[model samples]
Target: MRIRQRCGERARKRADRGPSGLSLLPWLLMGLGALSHLLGGQAPNPWIGAAGLLAFNTVYIAIVFRAFDRSRRESPLTWGLLVTLGLLTFGLAIGYGREWLLLFPLLGLGVGAVVRRGRLLPLIAFPLVVAVGAVTFWRDGWGSIGIVYGTFISIMVTAAILALDETVRELRETREELARAAVEKERLRFSRDLHDLLGHTLSVIVVKSEVVRRLAPRDLDAALAQVADIESVGRQALTEIREAVTGYREGSLATELDRARDALSTAGIEPVVRRSGPLLAPQTEALLSWVVRESATNAVRHSGASRCEIALSGSADRVRLTVTDDGRGPADGTPGSGLRGLRERVAAAGGTLDSGPAPRGGFRVTAELPVEASVPPEGDPAR
Candidate 1:
């Protein structure tokens, strides 16, 4: 029962790994060859020779299985057994006939598949086995037919097994590369979220902290209230950070617009926001909210403009957000990392974001998102 369970687990693992059925073909053919030998009355002691054939093929299958297990160290004992089996099969073929000679080259091929260091051995061993069979049969009155058949079978089997092995190795390497790419993608996402979340939150904290410092001596109560607000904002930032880590945090377009206005006011800039069209889907709204936050943050911190205008208007199938600030346009002809990261995010959501100097003056950030992207997933709580 334990052996059966182990076999079942192995089968499941093989299925999970890849379409590895090709590797089994060689073993099935070898088994069929053994069965043919037995049925054809080629062995003098049929039962004993059949048992020997089974034992050799079993060892050959084991060696092939070991080739796939990189974690397990290659056992020298296994290679020694292969050598011993090949010699024994050669002796049997010399005493009996050419049919037993096939097993000798088969043993060498199994060894070659497992032994990564001695790749040349199988090349030499297969041809030698064929040469020996040809010489023995030619001397025994059997002619070129025996030599050609032995050579063809030995070379074909060895080549087929090695080809299959190489294919499996390439597939495994490709899977590993894909896994690494997935990990890198996840890391980028984490960094982007942390930056978007903390950048705005920290900027607000700095502004409010400055407000408290200014009011501390002149207005004690107002300073104390500002300190309290700081504490509340810090706590909220902590909650949002935690949610962002778990990928559950959602944003609101209305909330972001209000915060953007407040942040602009604190920075001594006038913020004008206008919205039109029906309400957006939750995810789309959240993404647009992030745009507002990022735009407001950049306007306050980078752009030295005194006035910023944000316009949101689109049809039933689309939403457009245009943020324009009359600031010194592009500096050194490079967009900031914040905008670059935002571009990636927008693109992932099947949207387009264009940011550059406005023709009339200042800088402009315009984003257009599909209306369908706003729709929540079927089972989403927000839906």
Candidate 2:
């Protein structure tokens, strides 16, 4: 069983790999010649058989070699002549009682599996040749019944091995696809987190830098304080971004709300946040926090709105979060990169997010998460 399994594994690997046709043909021709010689009788008048064997082997070998040589420079004609010679050798082998000629079809099948690029002509031709050989053997009573049975088994086994090889190939392809998907998911997550971190921080820095520039000639103290605030905000942002980059960033709705308020305030926008939901599932909360940060950043950087509203609500089956700004809406009716990243993050958490111009001339982002966090019983805050 171990040997059979090992053979099957090797066959599968070979089928997955490409063929070396030139190298294979010589071995096949040599095997056919040896089989023919073995079955040739040793009688005194066996010169005719020997002569026929030698002529046929030489022709077959020449044809196979020519086929290999021309495969790079010639067309179907070379393969056609080689196959014809192979058929002639098959006939000679059977006529001389050469049971080893059975290797032809087996080798053909193996070669077909190796060179899987083109149409399956070799595969079909080999099986048909084997069928023809079997019929001839039955008719001529050349070999014993056991030989016929063995031939049938060999054909079946080859077919089974080829099928197994194809299955293994498909499985490998599936595994590769799954691995690619995993990598893509990680990339999306990293992009989303980076966007959220940098977008908010950069917007706040821009706003503070503008204030410092404008106030510098009028109020030196105020300008210096604003510059210091910028430095502090920049340091905090860098630390948080580093944590996110290192995969140590944890989500908290309260922390996100505070960050949102500070970011909007820096942009001279008032933020109103209302929360009435059950504590969210960790995944949902993480996604929602990203959405909050991204939406606030877009409002500060792109939307010219003066006020933004954030609301959260939950029920037994779902949770909903909405962020709205009373700023100038998108000119082209297209969500920007920040909003697009938010949508992807929400969708990955089995949620849906939509962002578009609100009817009242601002932008609106609404997301719904399907899973709800389990809440403790009333008055059981510790739980």
Highest-scoring model, lDDT: 1
Give one digit per residue, the lDDT tens place, for model 1 in 1-383: 99999999999787556533246436446445546777888768887777776776666666666655544316776666666655655565565565555554565455445544346656755566566665556535455354445544554565566556567768888998988987776677667767777888888788788988999989999989878877877898898888877767788899889989988877778999999987888888887888898888888877888999999999998899999999975576567777787776777777898899999989899999886573322212121
List per-candidate RMSD values in Å.
Answer: 10.3, 8.9
Q: lDDT tens digits, residues 1-383, model 2?
A: 99999999999787665233344344455355444455654323356556655665555445444432325314565556455655655665556544445445433433333333335644665575566567556545665444444444444554455446556667989998989987676666667667678878888899989988999999999999989989988998888877866666766778888989987987799999999957666666766777788888888888889999999998877999899999886767798877776665566556789988887868999989876533112101111
Query: Residue 43: error of model 2 in Å?
Result: 8.5
TM-scores for the candidates: 0.60, 0.67
lDDT scores in order: 0.71, 0.66
